[model samples]
Target: MINWKVRFKNRSWVMAFVAQLMIVAQMLLQGLNALGVTDFQLTDAVQQSILTFVNAVFILLSLMGIVQDPTTKGMSDSERAKTYKEPN
Candidate 1:
């Protein structure tokens, strides 16, 4: 079984997954449009808006992940430095 909590803790991974999902959705939509099943299409302004929204979401998630990282939680500067140091 997948550990959803652990998977979602890394914001970059979540962002990349969402981006791939969006690309797949766009491809499906394009296929449907070509088949004339639906006349759906996005204008340049709408596309720009979606891009901006996705970027904002990515930034917010990144900040939240940084703030919630368990390794550095409640650690003082010296302690954190030691914890993060190379083993060499």
Candidate 2:
């Protein structure tokens, strides 16, 4: 008795969750480097700034997924038949 729509929702949530997790990891690593725990081999300031910006973008995308309402992804007529057969 599993709904495919629910599964699709879970998939989106998992990807967003992983994206947010990576953001935290990247930010922490940058903070560590800022403290001089490790040297930034490639022009520290510039590269770190770029990496931070990319991570921020990823974080925003993830949050968008978390908050957005999902619309029916329009199933083909054949697939749509299955949905109609379900008890309303």
Candidate 3:
């Protein structure tokens, strides 16, 4: 079995995976609606809104990853000093 924690070690990877899942789910929902198995209404505006929200979430996750990266260190002095130190 695949361990999610090991496979998705970074927030960006996790967010991307989630975005893919959302895409698949949206497709499935649309298929179901076409087959008359669902009443889901994904109008252009609603679809655009959902896509925008997902993209925004991806951006936020990427920003969080950048903030916590060992390279960038941190935003403040105290954090920078601590981040530079070798982990024990």
Global CA lDDT computed for model 1: 0.60
lDDT per residue (tens digit) for residues 1-88 in model 2: 3354543456565566567677688778778887999876568688789788977777677567652335444332234434643422
The clash number for model 3 is 0
Each prediction's TM-score versus the true structure: 0.45, 0.45, 0.46
RMSD of 1: 10.2
Candidate 3 has a TM-score of: 0.46
For model 2 the local lDDT of residue 3 reads 53
> Against the hidden true structure, what lDDT does model 2 obtain?
0.61
Q: How much does candidate 2 score in TM-score?
A: 0.45
Q: Model 1, poorest ten-residue lDDT window?
A: 79-88
* TM-score winner: 3
